[model samples]
Target: MTSSEPTSTRRRLRRLWLPLAIGLVQVAGSYGAYRGQLERREPDALMVVLALIGPIALYWLRQRPVLVLTATTISTLTFMLLQYPYGPVILSFVISVFSAVIAGHRLAGWVAAAALYFGHVLGRIALGINEDGIYQSLAVGAWFVVMVIVAELVRNGRERSAAVARTRKQEELRRAGEERLRIAQELHDVVAHHISLINVQAGVALHLVDRQPEQAGTALAAIKEASKEALVELRSIVGVLRQSDESAPRQPVPGLERLEHLLSRTSGAGLEVYKTSAGLPHALPTSVDRAAFRIIQESLTNVVRHSGATKVGVHLQYGGTFFELWVDDDGNGVPETVVEGNGLVGMRERATALGGTMTTTRSPSGGFRVTAHFPLSAEDERDPD
Candidate 1:
């Protein structure tokens, strides 16, 4: 069975103590006052016993409300019969009505209320006590109704507050995810171009180093310049996420025109990449361009981190309505358990948020493959009437 939570424990303690403490103090004080009224004569032993029992019954009010109320009513009625005061008994009845309201049992509370009122009528009539009759009963009944309504309203308001808190938490998570994607796009753009130039120059220096030492020196200088540029661009790319002002120059992020640059960066990372495109377009929406760029970047990052392969392949197809990206590495393949690193999970989240699908599988030659398909733009997604 589920145990009581902390809030419930506190509520239970409050419910148990309030009725017992208040009822006992009032009953004792009333008994003392009545005893003083008959000081010259000996007090009625039975009236004193009934007064004590009425308060003692309150200890069980929360655990057994009906039984405790029944015991209280019997003792209070007996005290009235013996000509003791009715005020203490009337106070106990009011407490019982309030307890029943908060306890969520309207039918039971109403029945208990009716019984207490009838007992009051009997005690008053039997002892011929001249006091306000119908007015007193109606006042007590109204108190019960008010307490029940307040309890219900409090319960509903708390539920509404909790629901609002849950929705706000979900919105926060979604916004955080979007921020991460934006940062990823910025990093991809900042690094791709300079790395492209680095790879081109590196290849030229390596090819010309022996043929002509003089020309090779110039080519090697170009390689050094290219590598330094690549590092500066990389630092600036990473600095976007930092609150620093050591800004480096930035270049426009490669769009469709810069797919070659993307390929160059992969080659500079010492991984040969082959890319094929079909039905290529001139440009894409910024969001789609950013997403596509990040997906390819993450795929290559994973290859560098996990895929022990010398060569990778990238394939892109633009169908106007949608586009596809495929990256495959001839690594020893993903592990059988398919546990995902943060980069892989981020790529999947991006694809899913854009209403795209990403699939990862092991290729036949012990390699890893990733494919993502995304819509071209929001305008492309709207249905025509």
Candidate 2:
């Protein structure tokens, strides 16, 4: 069988003490307020015992709110019918109503509380029991109304608390999803570019070692450089993912300044890349800079793997308010029905995330082409749909 949640000693005592106190007050203590007694000396012990039973039953009010209220109402009516002095057994019924309302059982609690109040009055009249006065009935009715108002207020408070908890949970999940995506994108960019260079250079080293030992040394040197860059980037990613206490200072994100390193690696892999610019080189915003680098890196990696091109032409132009980028080759172009892969998707996502656009198609020179544009003006973002 399953057990309840573990409760602290203090909490367990608090849970027990209320019902115990209510039961005690209803039993022996209620006799003091009663004008008549069963005998000359002592109060009616049987009546006291029945009153005690009503309040003692309130222990399950939270978990079984409806059942507890219904049972308390029945027991309270039974005691009243037995001609017992009123002993605040109604207190337990009131608490059960509040609990049931907050527990999302408002209709049942209201019905039970209403029945409890009317039932008590009906039982008193039907049994021909003497009540204190008309004023006593008013006081009892007002107290029942007060309990209902309190129950509604408790329900409102609980609903607001539950709504806040749900909002917090949703925000937590959203941030976690974004973090996972960021990590995946970073790892993909790092591994794809560096591993492509390393693979190509390793092949060059093996091929040239048997013929030209000098060319073999150059290939080995390129491999070392590529591996070192890969390790540095991988370590930075590890630092990014480490627990806060174990986290190291982060390396700066790759930007256009790293363009030279990318060009060198591709050059060493035997793909000559020609660069052209229409404007003076200038610093770019962090978002645009990183997106631009990843786009070019993925473009070149794809060219190496897919395009049987000997050379690539790269152009960068800054036309006052926007930056235009193009990477085209003179080799077998991509198929007409190009299936978009992760690299293509990542390039588009990076560009769009920075309020830019990217396109890929077969170039006029019978080679694949990647083109992207970035807006230098913040006006693009400020425009409303």
Candidate 3:
């Protein structure tokens, strides 16, 4: 907690000084009235003045609620023992009870109120104020009971407000967790896919320089394309994370329609791929399209990095309510030493978030294969783009 924060003493006094000051004035007026009612109207100069300052002193320690209540109770009992009338002298003690209850000291407040009320009544009667009448006695006790009830109500409201604040904080934390997972998935897919392609194309350029000088240009061109796309997508991710209002356009994340760009780069890495898409190429939802593109991009990158596959096949099929993706390569199947990697986990998470499934297995053609199926919403259609 910083000194400038609201919890600091200066801020707390600013917020609560109003009610305490009002209560102090009320107590002072009550003391004046009690002195006027007595036969010996001369104020017992010391106790009367102490009663006036007692509540104000307690107000300064409003942060130490229990101490405020306890001190006020002692002061009130001392005033009564001196044969003081049932007067505004007790008003400060009531305010203390309210303070303690509102501070979540409910049990202590109730116990203090009970003890002080009886003590005041007993002291008044012993001093002959009760002999005045039955009506006066009933009225004094009733007022004391009302103060206790009011304090309890204030405490209940404070507790309810605290409960609501706690619930809202928990909800915010849950949303933050989901957003962090999504960002992590995005970084893994973008970096893994682009870096793998660059690594393969660079190797191709190096190998062909001596034997096929002209083809090296093609490999370098593919590396350039892959790096450019990676930069754009990474920029979009950064724009989403930036706090400033001034930002670059980040909409339209990559989709399967842009899959040819990835394929061209993969081909440059010396992988021969046969691609087929059935049905008209109607557009898909950004979420579904992005996931599909990333899934394919990752699968091909894995093939280049781990599968040692030279020839690959990719199939895309659209249906009324769902779309399917399949990628297979003719290579020495998935190696037994291979383990599930971050790319595979990222792809599966993306599919599941879109209410879909992604699966991978050893293909019948003696290579690895990956399949993804995602349900489509009406929003998936993008006006034939």
- Top candidate on lDDT is 2
Model 1 root-mean-square deviation: 9.7
What's the best-to-worst order under lDDT? 2, 3, 1
- As for model 2, its CA RMSD to the true structure in angstroms is 4.2
TM-score of candidate 1 against the unseen true structure: 0.48
Candidate 3: regions farther than 4 A off: 1-31, 39-42, 56-60, 80-87, 125-145, 278-283, 335-338, 376-385
Estimate, for each residue in 116-222, the C-alpha lDDT of model 2 and write its tens digit.
77887777787686554778877878887788878889899988999999999999999988777777787898889888888888998999999998889998999
Better of 2 and 3 by TM-score: 2
In terms of TM-score, the best-performing candidate is: 2
* Stretches > 4 Å off in candidate 1: 1-122, 130-143, 166-260, 270-274, 280-288, 302-312, 328-346, 361-368, 375-385
Model 2 segments more than 4 A misplaced:
1-15, 35-43, 80-83, 128-139, 244-247, 278-283, 319-322, 375-385
- TM-score of every candidate relative to the true structure: 0.48, 0.85, 0.82
Model 3: residue 151 alpha-carbon error in angstroms: 3.3
User: Model 2: how far is 113 from its true place, Å?
Assistant: 1.4
For candidate 3, the TM-score is 0.82
The model with the greater lDDT, 2 or 3, is: 2
- Residue pairs in candidate 1 whose N, alpha carbon or C atoms collide under 3 angstroms: none
